[model samples]
Target: MMTTAVPAPAISVRGLEKSFDDLRVLRGVDLDIERGSIVALLGSNGAGKTTMVRILATLTRPDAGTVMVDGFDVMTDGANVRECISLTGQFAAVDQILTGRENLKLVAKLRHLDDPGGIADEFLARFDLVDAGSRRVAGYSGGMRRRLDIAMSLVGNPPVIFLDEPTTGLDPEARIEVWTMVQELATRGTTVLLTTQYLEEAEKLADRIAILHEGRIVANGTLAELKELLPPAEVEYVEKQPSLEDIFLALVGKNAPEGELR
Candidate 1:
């Protein structure tokens, strides 16, 4: 008789707990993210979203609980966990003095890739930064800098990536561009865990959504599943119209061809 093997989750958390002195940041949190899927950790500020990402990325140790990335225990196999994951925090980490190409090359070289130059060029083109690759990062627009930050994370092609509020502070068009890039990453088999404040962003990109409220996940599931948890909508007389976000985007396109707020 033949048997099938069950693949381990790309990311798994069990009874996760964290604290900063007397303040509890995460309270008995548990999560599981499957391979090649995108999971959005939605939360308000101080909701422990960044803390969870840090623990999973091996940057910080949790006070209690098990965290596994690609089947490796984060605590005991921190180095192995790091090998399988890349993290881009809330802010861009690129060096202002280095050209975009240089930033990619630096990451590639640090990871000891055989052909750093080739890898740099590949990411530059992939992230739509080839034209701006030679210019110092300081001169790059907010969108361009964010793209480069993500591009640098992909230098080693880790199977899992953590993006913490990746689209924050971007104009609408730039936010959409980053959202598109995130979808592309998941399509290519990278499991992505992103923290975001935007409900619309999660609805657009996530295979599953986990809402963290005051250090605990209040809801976790597919969009429809999560919606099921909400109270039934009250009957309305008027037909439903577009959301404010939709109306805002439409207006921006019409009133500002460049997509910038004056």
Candidate 2:
């Protein structure tokens, strides 16, 4: 019988450390993200999630520990690590002055890829922005702008994508749109590591959830696995009935003036 070796993770961090003067952002954090999977980094406002992402993307150097992306060391092989990763920050980085298509083309050109126009066209169609391709990004909706920003980050098909608080300021509807987009990225074999404070977002998107607290990953596992950390709740059953509010709404919908309840 022959045994197959396990493949290396797309992104790996061990004993990572970082500090800013008196503030220590990360302390001996370790994580491994499998290839083509979505891993949500969950933390509160000051949990250093962004700091960890910056180090992985090679935008910031870690004070200690070994970090690797796509088999390339972030400290020693910075360029290769960068080539393997794309970082999308909290806010959309699209140009308000340029058309949505132009923004994609600009990124494609910067990456030195052949046929920027074609790349732009492909992404615009893929992100369902073909109609708004020619309109200035300033006129696009929040969801549309976010989609375009993500498409720009993917111009060169980087193997790993870092989304740092991707849906920070979007409305509920817009947030849902971005959530769907994140799911699509994983389905297309793109490895995504998104940092977010929204617990529901992590529950809905991540294959595995890692909770960062006080500069360390305190918990890491799937939703069910995390649930096992706590004692299971006592199962209870009770009769249910519609409340007065629910009954009133139901009645209004059927009998209100001109069906105005809608």
Candidate 3:
């Protein structure tokens, strides 16, 4: 009899736990992300989202449990894990003094790429930053800086990436730009694990979503599956109302008609 081979997950975690002094951040978390897929880890404030990313990225050691990225154990094979993954934290990590092109070149050089300048120019074009690549990053807009930060992370072309609250503090248009870039990355077969507080962001980008609460994953599934977990929608006498976000956007001209106010 012939048997088929099962591919290894891009990222796998089993019974993961972490603690700092008297505080326990993660409590027996488990996750599995398929190769070339995007997964969103959702959680509220102080819900251990950052801690989980830190452990998986090998920046912090988990007190217990196991984490494997592309079949390499995060704890025992940290160097290999690092080589296969790129991480973009909450804040932009680009140097303020360097131009956008220089920032990308710096990362490429650090990774020992043979043609750092060529790679830098390629990514600048890819991220639509060619116009601003020559200007100092300190003078760039928040969206431009964020784009440069992500471009730098791609210098080595790692197979997997971790984006921790990547769109934080950006205006709506800027956030949409970043979202488009992220979608392009996934389409190119990069496995992405991102932590986000925005439900809309997850709904738009993630193939599957996992919610963390009180240090444990309370729910994990696709958006439709998760919606099934909730009570069925009830019939209402009145028309459904728009969300606060919808109202805010409508009032602030975001959703208003051009040359007219609602």
Cα RMSD to native, each candidate?
Answer: 8.5, 11.3, 8.6
In terms of lDDT, the poorest run of 10 residues in model 2 is 253-262
List, residue by residue over 118-169, the lDDT tens digit for candidate 3: 9999999999999998999999999999999999998888999999999999
After superposition, the stretches of candidate 1 with alpha carbons farther than 4 Å from their true spots are: 1-3, 237-262
What TM-score, over all chains together, does every model reach? 0.89, 0.88, 0.89
How far is 133's C-alpha from truth in model 1 (Å)?
Answer: 1.1
Instruction: Count clashing residue pairs in model 3.
Output: 0
Candidate 2: the clashing residue pairs are none
lDDT of 1 at 75: 95
- Misplaced by over 4 Å in model 2 are 235-262
Please tell me which model should have the higher TM-score, number 1 or number 3. Answer: 3
Return the clash pairs for model 1, or none.
Answer: none
What does the lDDT come to for candidate 2? 0.84
What overall lDDT goes with each candidate model?
0.85, 0.84, 0.85
**Which whole-number lDDT from 0 to 100 does residue 2 have in model 3?**
95
Clashing pairs in 3: none
Model 2 error, position 43 (Å): 1.0
* lDDT (10s digit) by residue, model 1, range 120-188: 999999998989999999999999999999999988899999999999899999999999999999999
lDDT of 2 by residue, 1-262 (tens): 9999999999888999999998988989989999999999876677798889988888888999999899999999999888878999998999999999999999998999999999999999999999999999999998899999999999999989999989988999989988998999899899999988777788799998787766877667776666544433344655344332232233223432222110
